[model samples]
Target: MNKNEDSVKNSEFGFGESNDAYAKYFFGQSYLKRLASNSDEKINVSNVSFEPGCRNNWHEHSIAQILIAVAGEGWYQAEGQVAQKMLPGDVVIVPAHTKHWHGADKDSWFAHLAIMVGDAKTDWYESVDEAEYEKLN
Candidate 1:
């Protein structure tokens, strides 16, 4: 038997089934891989992937949320702020109750490891305006 077989096996790293429950909060498509969803554990985590031109609505968390960019490129922006480019190894710490949004760039597939601290409840809001999104340069 090959000892390296585990590493060689094909796997779905980022791409996965779409999460339809929050479909209304996103544009294009996105996938969710729940790594941890137990509140008793104190911290929850997930692996999220965004297709090109896909993004979630403006939202906020009750406590705080951290996103560790792990693959490709994407954009992150807080309310009334310029959109910031995010690449692998980038880390974003969103303060509690601050409205923000994140997703893949128009031409990139993006993935991130999301870590939520405390019992933060995500407050999702309105979708991004396409006209305004197009103006993002």
Candidate 2:
């Protein structure tokens, strides 16, 4: 792992490894740590961490998704909406099928617990518009 990946892995959240499996869907480096999953219970939880300036592509879930910010700062923006700044303890409830994206701020690492309410499938769309993202603070 490179220096930045190593530092993110050792972040306060201490969640999963470098998220290479889904790297293609993200604009920059991100880590994934699966915290819980139960087929019978139909529940899934993961701690996702992003390096500074890292963000995922626009996507939507078949079911609602809940993101609880655990460390640093980030941005969450739904289609046609202004990006929302997120910090520790901030929560974002993303309605099912909403085109949106979330990731670390330009100068901060970000971590959040993603709780999947049920057996949700995600449909990833194009990357967030670069010009639009750069406009965010």
The numbered model that scores best in TM-score is 2
- Clashes per prediction? 0, 0
RMSD per model, one decimal: 6.2, 2.8
**Candidate 1 RMSD computed on C-alpha atoms after optimal superposition onto the true structure:** 6.2
TM-scores of the candidates are 0.84, 0.90
Off by over 4 Å in 1: 1-14
Off by over 4 Å in 2: 1-13
Cα lDDT of model 2 by residue, 1-137, tens digit: 43244545665657688899999999988989988889998999899999889999999999999999887789999999989998878999999999999999887888888898687899999998889888888
Top-lDDT structure, candidate number: 2
In angstroms, give how far residue 97 of model 1 lies from its true place. 0.5
